[model samples]
Target chain A: MDTQQAAGTSVLPADPGALTPAEARAAFRSGLAVPTAGWSRGFAQANLIIVPRDLAFDVLLFAQRNPKPCPVLGVLDAGETSGPLLAGGDIRTDVPRYTVYRDGQKVDEPTDIRQYWRDDLVTFIVGCSFTFESALREGGISIAHIDQNVNVPMYRTEVRCEPAGSMAGPLVVSMRPVPASQVADAVRITSRYPAVHGAPVHVGNPHELGIADLARPDFGDPVDMPEGHVPVFWACGVTPQAAVMESRPALAIGHAPGHMLITDARDSQYLVP
Target chain B: MDTQQAAGTSVLPADPGALTPAEARAAFRSGLAVPTAGWSRGFAQANLIIVPRDLAFDVLLFAQRNPKPCPVLGVLDAGETSGPLLAGGDIRTDVPRYTVYRDGQKVDEPTDIRQYWRDDLVTFIVGCSFTFESALREGGISIAHIDQNVNVPMYRTEVRCEPAGSMAGPLVVSMRPVPASQVADAVRITSRYPAVHGAPVHVGNPHELGIADLARPDFGDPVDMPEGHVPVFWACGVTPQAAVMESRPALAIGHAPGHMLITDARDSQYLVP
Candidate 1:
């Protein structure tokens, strides 16, 4: 057997776009857990938010009102792991890792959430901006953080999201450093994928959004901003997760930051125009 | 005091668009409950769907999956009829007419649903195509049904909508006769409003949709089709109502055909690109 197969490593091929959604999911299911950044290239990566059925309605409404920050890709019924749109995919084992919360406090980070499974837990897979990064790359744009091999920096902003029931909090955003000349191209390309946070919520001024420093983000590693680069911000999937923290549901479950659920749905399928 | 005042008619002013949404809603509240065809010219008109909380998630998912046929404008929380989105509007007494269905059968058509309103009921305002018809009219296209002073014809097709939980049924569509010259214009104008069941679902052929006759329709009145015109069909809001019938929920309430809930939201608010 080849050394590649012997290691049992799910190292992406040289051309990561060749990876399939099902294959990446299988890798996760088989305990080959890792950050799913380069895997399942064309398929959309989703932010999984699982909550007890009692709080599902509030969270669903929160996602609906703050669609730009929390564009929902698919919502699975309570206790049902498989969905029709996902082509019989399993939610419990499909994601590499999960973060479990109790009363808005992070308590445990589990590789598999099989022990925490309950009949009243509702699962919602929200669209991640990672789905649109591929489009920007295809459009001949360079993402600064990806080049640095790190998670995209995210910040807590002053902009308050539209509140629903008990779910209310400030908006969260992920930053990308784009050359001044490519700002319009970035917006144009991202606008097509509204299902993935649409266009940039803020473009030129980070301070206007209550982001004090680009170097120290609330989450993820910061990237260097070159002379000709301007920071662009898109509504982050973390907004709903942050709101969940503020709302303090009895129990909440989500993917660990940077790890995502790769679905069979292609990014192109979510394009509006 | 004046001819217009003596007639007690809220006739269109020189600029009908100048009419405030509150004035239009007040008109309906005062028993001026007629088909809201020309009221609040540029404001959006929505189809009202109310169901018990037990079936709320199923209905919400159904609308999300079959967005074209059931584009939702606002979904109110269970038991709360007042919403911030609608600007202090009350769902129970706001709409002019409602059709109540019990166990998949029509039971009553009530003007105000205040008596039937329950604490566990959830109200949903699904976007009606009537909002887009005004845009079509503004684009210099004439509507046959408006000229003929009749309801747009609707038919049941063999095409099944994506089911959610107990919600499952054949798709229902509304038909309009468009001149060969204006078909493209209709599609372009309506495509801007995705929240209003944007664009034509099927154009030129009814037989392919399992629709056998143009003159005979399951709902609404059939209008005359001119020789130069072809029938164009749009996904109708009645679809969920039909699905409610197929699902046989304990009780389902919806707006009577042709009557809709006019909202403070402008039709332009729903336009995407």
Candidate 2:
């Protein structure tokens, strides 16, 4: 059996949310494949993107240009498997699952990426909206996706990102139905963590963002829009992946959606104030 | 006569402080070299560093690792001369003066760098402390350097920067003596501008930072210490230049001391809420 099939047979932790970030990573390293939402409570989880050294500068420039959609938490230089964010953890094997892309097409979904590791590849650890969701919950706001027990709904809009070299694509956003009264609190709370996707890009009227149907999303499962709650959109980490897919590099790798790299950094560390 | 010598004979504007950023650049483009301390009062001034494309990534990584000392305002990609920060301004001719270095040794200090421009060069525009100095002054904090009619005193501290590839150097800081009562105000006002070297790195006791004498600064002129005042230091923009010098890149270019690029971006734009 392949690594993915073998990992599928492994049992997951009973209470993954209570595990320390290191412990959670250890579970993934031990061949337990699972989505990482609420895996480490207060610890920050990161979106991963690995690109070759030649295109690394362009990716960094793209992230710098479009910070809302791509807040770089940390960068592991070419051939560097570990850095400040993932102490004692090998990036190639710690993630629960990875999506490998070849010429913009998904070729394999591997449990570990050690076979594909290259000396010229650079890893960019991007901030995920999961960090701010905790803050939003702490502020007495309820998230529709979390309440519905599904992945957050994401849509690609007509808004084009500020392009850097060959990296260019339409802006992608995740949706949540928040009560009108708590919208301001959500914005104020999330704005403090600019390292993650901060504040709502569009508070109401999905049509303004060229999103036709609220029930249909380009990625993830749809959540119910409760009465008296408005649809809110935040810049999604998937925007970079979309750019990579559109740009069509020789090889690209990312964590499977909803399956992220649990980092050693705490959510509070990204809070500006 | 060369551009510098010819520009030395050019007449300067009667009130440079009242000129717009574009007008200031026009004057500098005409080969008139002068310090940009009070020019275009409300607009932002930036420190300039240009390196070959091969070394750009290391510099960007270094700046990311050491943000306080090198807050990147904007970057011009290899062979890219204009961008969002400076509209209609040419990076090569808009600055008041340029310092060219060959293998880390100063080779030229010319008014214009058009002759030194190359297609593979990448320019990095770094934030200057002048943006926050105005905020401090507005908050009722008197600035010692401006009051004493001298360049801000800067010292090389013993604290080493987090290294990235070939980039590594000690943290350099600019000093201003603020009254004990206004130290908190100074911190509060400047903290709002993280893009421009936010907050004081060291407040009192220069010995703690390995500075034996306050009067003998490694760069810039020393200012007087008013009675009941304590020395306050902010990370200097020179830190990157120091790193470039230490790293010994084949070629590097920077703005001469006190001479800066007046960007179209306003000081208020950099102020965080």
Candidate 3:
């Protein structure tokens, strides 16, 4: 089996870590639609949130007020795609697929959002948990979902996010099972990547976060937990989507679950120290 | 001498560190106008900025793009004075003094901005270097300006700030001298407080940063540096004022040089680790 198969990645470049950000973007723009989990390897992949200019401040405030769940990587001006950090990257056609929402309901999924582009649409690229997962793997920690080639399970928690403006929602978290022996190591490695959902919000106590069952998740698929493992949860970037849906904005667009926009920022750049 | 007198602090409450944020702010509103140097000792004091709603985005973007110099503590909504972090603290009269800028000129310095308050005004409370100064003193690090009972010497460096929209100018930096033996410890301690200008940007190399003379400063008073001391530069919060002045916005307001807004956030809350 190739390295992709060995790592249980869906479809990644031959040299995943070696694939530069430009190559990853080119892959997505060329209609190579797939989950961005293993593709850019060492670079951060971002969640996309496009909203009308009228609601832009509320959304930005949501991210600022709830940084743990929605650590914003960059905010592009209205009618603008490329930001100072994500220079030369297109927001409309990036990330392989886009899901448009209206009034808290999913309306349509499109391959590219060129047709929906509006002058008032503002794009916010938020940091994703993938950066921390990579750090976990680097430290010899085995991620259960990655091992099984399944999507990581996510749950809406009892923890309400610190609200901003008219936006407020429960914190959504992605769960991973780690051997009790390696819990401290997991915390240490993930704490180093704060920009990308750094550190676990809860360790072993899913009930405290309002998580009822590991087998049932609000988003993504569940994974089989091996013995001697405890569930660890990190703030998920999918939060802004939930927050937007709650407020029911007339126009909202985001990357389909798993599909993400690849950025040029190195994952190591987000490391705390 | 009392502890405040030995610290060369201007008029402070009998138990300076023991005074609460509310008491300190009430003192200001009651016309107890003095430098907020030693008052409310453990609480983080703030540098205040106010601009019209039209220019709020540009100003906020400046702080977001240049966090080192303008680390935002909290941003209040337009026409709103209280923030989540600065709760119960009035933005208008709580600051001992306010400076009004019109088309880049200082038109008035008011004790309270109640008359100048406009519905379109947005308040931005930025992290001041005073928090880090306290941290330094806690670590047995001597601050020359505080010891001399004078304002910290600030210089306009040749280093260009990261421009955000219409906001752009040379970076304003505050200079503090450290003993050669304590420079590393100083950096280690200060780096813990990223919200307050973090660690020194440049150490021991004023010419490299385009600073000509240590004794001659663009703002504030110069202090004596003893032998074997090296100049360390930290990004100063006054950078926004410099940027605003250069851009010459139609209307702008900020705290007077020595006067600052005391907030409810504890200085220890900003400690990263």
Candidate 4:
């Protein structure tokens, strides 16, 4: 075995995209910390939301009610650390980083959550827009955020989600600049993956969604917009985390923004004909 | 007002197919009891399952895990009756009839369930295969049960659903005998409605699904199979009811077989593309 494997230290593959979902997870488990974009290229990545058992129903209901914003990929039963989505993997240590929220406030950013994990906490794995980015690229549309080497801009819109019990919040959308000629192609390509955040909710004007400024996003970094490029907004995975924050549950946990759980499931598994 | 309307009694429209979803719901609310197949022709009908709030998360998770048999159309939050799926509708009284289950056994089949209604009960409106029957007809495939004037036959399959929490049961499938030539057409048509039971699980042979005999069904009335017809099976909405029966939750409620809640939402709303 290599020295890095023996020491349980990071020796990530030179071509990150070549690593399997499990390999990427193992790297994260071995203390490699980085955003998961462009990692495990053909596999899918998921957003994480952990809430106490008492509040899980509300979260599940919220996802059912607002599927576009909170498409559930799979859920782990309360205290379960592994499921089919993560074969031979531990949820507590698989993700690159985790955000701990207490009473809706950010309290800690940890690499391992076993210390804070509770038997009463249920984990929800939600679809991420990253899964469809490959489809967009295949359809000949370039991703602005990827080109700019920054996080995709996300804004909390004025549109309120269909509330479910105690869970409610404004829809959060991630924006990408699509070339004027390729906006339709982008929509057609991304719409095929409804399990992920499918289709553009808005095109051309960010102000229409109550987004005052493109450069000032509620979360993530803004991409450079070239002239003749239109801003296409998609329902963001962060919407549930926003809901968790607004509801102010006693405890909640989520993947650190931009970092995600790479799953064994392939991207083609989500693409509809 | 017409005498029939004034009496608060049945004066159903001569052409039951012409009645709007609201009108059909009104008929049911006013003591009319009949199968909803041909009524409200263009609107979507739903399967009903009500469980106490304590068991709702498990039910929701179960549905999430097995979406083919339990595509949730909409969910009525606990203690709430009306929502987007049914405008100005009362769940307790609008459905043609309800089957009350006590510890897995059928206790009552009542036209109205107000007396049994509880504040803690959460109602799940699941998609029914009836929505796709029209698409099949439009594709020039005749339905056996409709032609025979009998209920669609359902059977318990050897296939076990991906369980969630305490909810676990064998998949129950509805079988329709289609002419061998139109088998592809039936699958293509029904696959368009993923919100309903999408596509056939098996295209031929009854014994493949552990069904001993096509004439003897686990639920609903069996139909006459034509000489050239092949047994096609689709995941049935009874799957959740089967789970309820096997899990033996203290109290559970479901729509009696062949009777359903005709929602205001149109069938086109559920048809993909």
Candidate whose lDDT is highest:
4
Off by over 4 Å in 3: A1-18, A84-87, B1-15
* Displacement of the residue A229 alpha carbon in candidate 1, Å: 1.5
For this target, which candidate reaches the highest TM-score against the unseen true structure?
A: 4
Candidate 3 lDDT score relative to the true structure: 0.82
Clashing pairs in 2: none
Whole-model lDDT per candidate: 0.83, 0.86, 0.82, 0.88
Q: What TM-score against the true chain A does chain A of each candidate get?
A: 0.93, 0.93, 0.91, 0.96
Lowest-sum lDDT 10-residue window in model 4 chain B: B1-10
True contacts kept of 2: 0.06
Q: How well does candidate 4 score on lDDT at residue A131?
A: 93
Candidate 1 lDDT score at position B185: 96
Candidate 1 residue-wise lDDT at A186:
99
Q: By DockQ, who's the top model here?
A: 4
Residue-level lDDT of model 3, residues B75-155, one tens digit each, is 888899787666787788788888899888889988789988998898888998888778899899998887787878889
Q: DockQ for all models, in order?
A: 0.47, 0.53, 0.37, 0.93
Give one digit per residue, the lDDT tens place, for model 3 in A1-273. Answer: 244433434355566557777766766665666666666788888888999877877787788678788888887888997765556767876577788999979898886788889988988888988887788988999888767877778898989897777788889998989999999999999987878888888999999888888899887789998899989999998898888888898989998766788898888899877
Clashes of 4: 0
